[model samples]
Target: MASQPIKSDGGSSSYYLIPNGARDLLDLIEHKRMEFGIGNIFKACYRLGEKDGTSKRYDLNKIIFFAQRELARLPKDA
Candidate 1:
């Protein structure tokens, strides 16, 4: 399935995609990181897992790793 696009306040050009069931976790991490800082990504994941029962099954570290890797691949201008 095609990945879903994530909206960012930065601009239309600043966006990312989340594939599979990791969308919510990634979205929460991205939003929290932008609002708080990179240090909060793991905290956000833990909080989301506690609040959202379905998120517990996902491997937060793996998701963050892959997401960051994919985001890094985007053009610097993007």
Candidate 2:
């Protein structure tokens, strides 16, 4: 039988396909540092920073990561 991917209740899919013979210590390092603390519902807008080292008004928009509901379906109340 073929192996199936695992689906989490959070609506995300994950799978482990590494071979048993693989050996690489550096592979353990996180690519983007495991995200925690704040959730993924936030956006990263890069605008001109003030001289006082503070983020200025949002002059641009970029969706680093959007909410699942926003990506999945329309708002029910709308």
Candidate 3:
């Protein structure tokens, strides 16, 4: 999805709102794990969204949900 530019606090920013937030966040988590390894999934996910300019639009509930789900999937030794 294309990001929308929004104005807030007298500033402008762009963000993409996931059509299916839960599924998109889960897919993003898995993709990051594969590409970046399991160092810090939550932070990685946040950073990825920031880099992609989509973090602001990601649903807070879905973020928490996928973060916990991804953390549980991490290897104990990782």
In model 3, the Cα lDDT at residue 24 comes to: 52
C-alpha lDDT (0 to 100) for residue 78 of candidate 2: 40
**lDDT (10s digit) by residue, model 3, range 26-55:** 565554343333334455555655656546
TM-score of 2: 0.16
Q: In order, what lDDT does every prediction score?
A: 0.54, 0.34, 0.50
lDDT of 1 by residue, 1-78 (tens): 115666567855434544345555556465434433343455545575665554654547545765686578779997
Candidate 3 residue pairs in clash (backbone atoms < 3 Å): none
Where is model 1 more than 4 Å wrong at Cα?
A: 1-58
Residue-level lDDT tens digits of model 2 in 1-78: 124545668654443443355454223213223232112222233223422444443312223234343545546674
The better candidate by lDDT, 2 or 3, is 3
RMSD of each: 11.1, 11.6, 13.9
Candidate 2: deviation at residue 60, Å?
Answer: 8.9
Candidate 2: lDDT of 44? 34
Candidate 2, lDDT over the whole model: 0.34
